[model samples]
Target: MKINDVILRTVTKIVVFIILTLSVYLFFSGHYSPGGGFIGGLVLASAIVLMYLTSDIETVHKGMPFDFKLVAALGVLIATGTGFASVIFGKDFMTQAAMKLNLPIFGETELASVVLFEAGVAMTVIGVVVTIILSISEDE
Candidate 1:
């Protein structure tokens, strides 16, 4: 027999949103403070895992129709591509460049290649972690 979890599901909805919000904050704050892509990705993965814990795998998979392995591959490609771009410009591998740009919403901001690299790292982490979690759950 299955146990009813209406309350758990309701709370999960709110908690997941909060966690995702925090992850984004952590990702953006990495440039200035002590948070970054790896932590952000872990937080994001936790939200996904929480969802899975609250519901069935099929439902979660239906909502997130992504092949995590592909995600990881793409992340690696993106990260390496950023490095190769520096090489193409006669700089060392993984060289990061930054520039100041004035955008309408954010005003003057420093844009850096490190953000792209971090994004790739975040995606890779999310993919690998989620894949591992799913694989482990499958053994049940």
Candidate 2:
């Protein structure tokens, strides 16, 4: 059976972009506000899920071409690395540092190590969620 899904695919493209943009905003705003790595990662995973829902796993994989397991491992490595970095510097584990730098684009921008940690967390969430979804889908 040839099912017609032109409208769904068209709308998905736009919706996915919006979701990804929102996810990025959520991630960046996390340090100062309610949103953070966990929520942002959830939102990101949702976007990926939406893509899978719109089409077959094979098709989505063609576009994304990601090994989710590796993604998860890398995320863990990154998150743990940040913590170990503190230890290497003779500080307690997971100790965070921040600094302010003046730049031509954004003046007096504050950069912190916590952002890296959050990024790791976000990547982990995305990988694990997608992997679980794929596993369940395969059961059918």
Candidate 3:
């Protein structure tokens, strides 16, 4: 590729990656604060759409290989399972899971089901987005 094309491609990749990372962070943070899974997932999915557009089929096939689809599925399962947990316990949907945390560097933390639900949402959002992008990009 020409130097100009190479520069453009690199910049594009960097920008997309930054946007994707920020979205994931925002989605995760939103669980405690203002953000939540739906918006976060959509933001993540949109970034993947950009990636699908910018990349060729071969590149996407090699890089992701449908893994995102599986991840998204797992995320849904987790979220759904959380609901089930509440129902089984005769509590409301996504009642706190009563969990413990070990953050390594940050040390221990208190974890709750709502936060876990957010994690599931974050994964689902990121995964579904990547999956959609790959599928749509390939369709083109």
lDDT of 2 by residue, 1-140 (tens): 99999999999999999999999999999988888888899999999999999998889999999999889889999999998999999999999999999989888899999999999999999999999988888745
In every candidate, how many clashes are there?
Answer: 0, 0, 3
Candidate 3 residue lDDT tens string, 18-53: 887877787767745777777777877777677666
lDDT of each: 0.93, 0.92, 0.74
Off by over 4 Å in 1: none
Indicate whether candidate 2 or candidate 3 has the larger lDDT.
2
Residue clash pairs of candidate 1: none
- Tens-place lDDT digits, model 1, residues 42-104: 999999999989997889989999999999889889888998999999999999999999999
RMSD of 1: 1.1
In the predicted model 3, the residue pairs found to clash are 30-35, 45-129, 97-113
Candidate 3 worst ten-residue window by lDDT: 131-140
Superior candidate under TM-score, 1 versus 3: 1
